[model samples]
Target: MSRFTTACIVGGLAAASAFASTPAQAGYYILRWDNTGICQVWSEAFTFKPIRWPSGYKIVSRPVPTFNEAVNLQVRLRRQGRCTL
Candidate 1:
């Protein structure tokens, strides 16, 4: 097979894998500024299964609009299965 064909095949397989795991392995994350009075900022990163490819992954930084919102978002993200590692 040609190199293009091989790459296409690999990509297709990876896409399938990501799609299959997305429902079970997808997640999000959030960050909130704490009492340190903006002096301290919270940040986190997580990866979720891609929507259409298995080896595919999504890495995102947690974002929070307000301090209270941050806490709530964090909880939601955790429950959603956000990847910590």
Candidate 2:
């Protein structure tokens, strides 16, 4: 291959490898009890399967908001009589 072509291929491979090696940003969520609207817990990371949350609890996906916002929302929801432990 030409020198320029070889350089381009190598650079492209390097960039691809770098991107592939980087880890994806994880999402956070809250699990609030359906009956009480007071008992709430934060998940360690996002998941599809049922987490270890107690029975009658619902998952609140908070993937876009900041961590503080997620926590605050959970507290606010509980205070507003939305859900409980």
Candidate 3:
């Protein structure tokens, strides 16, 4: 097969595996997009699945135990002028 075909297969597998994985933990995190300085509180089962494409967001805080905590963290980050949008 050509290189493009192989790459497509790998990306497809990564996306599928990312969806199929079981939950390892339940928590919230504050993610900031490096390109846009955008911050948001995300809630998802914690897993280390590989992404199928390039990513711009990174977690800025440890797994927060609750939604309230995550929101508080996001507020602080914004107040500090570190994250926005």
Quick one: best lDDT, which candidate? 3
The Cα local distance difference test for each model comes to 0.47, 0.66, 0.82
lDDT per residue, candidate 2, 1-85, as tens digits?
9999999999999999999999766555676665555545454554565545555666764554457767777777667766553
Instruction: Give all TM-scores, in the order shown.
Output: 0.28, 0.47, 0.57
1 against 2, candidate with superior lDDT:
2
Instruction: Summarize candidate 1's per-residue lDDT along 20-74 as a digit string, tens digits.
Output: 8774422333322222211122433334322332223333345454556655655
Clashing pairs in 3: none
Candidate number achieving the greatest TM-score relative to the actual structure = 3
Writing each residue's lDDT as its tens digit, candidate 3 over 20-80 gives 8965557898888777787888877644633424557778889888899999999999999
Identify the runs in model 3 with alpha carbons over 4 angstroms from their true place. 1-25, 46-55
Cα displacement (angstroms), candidate 3, residue 19, comes to 26
TM-score of candidate 1 to 2 decimals: 0.28
Query: How far off is residue 29 in model 1, in Å?
Result: 20
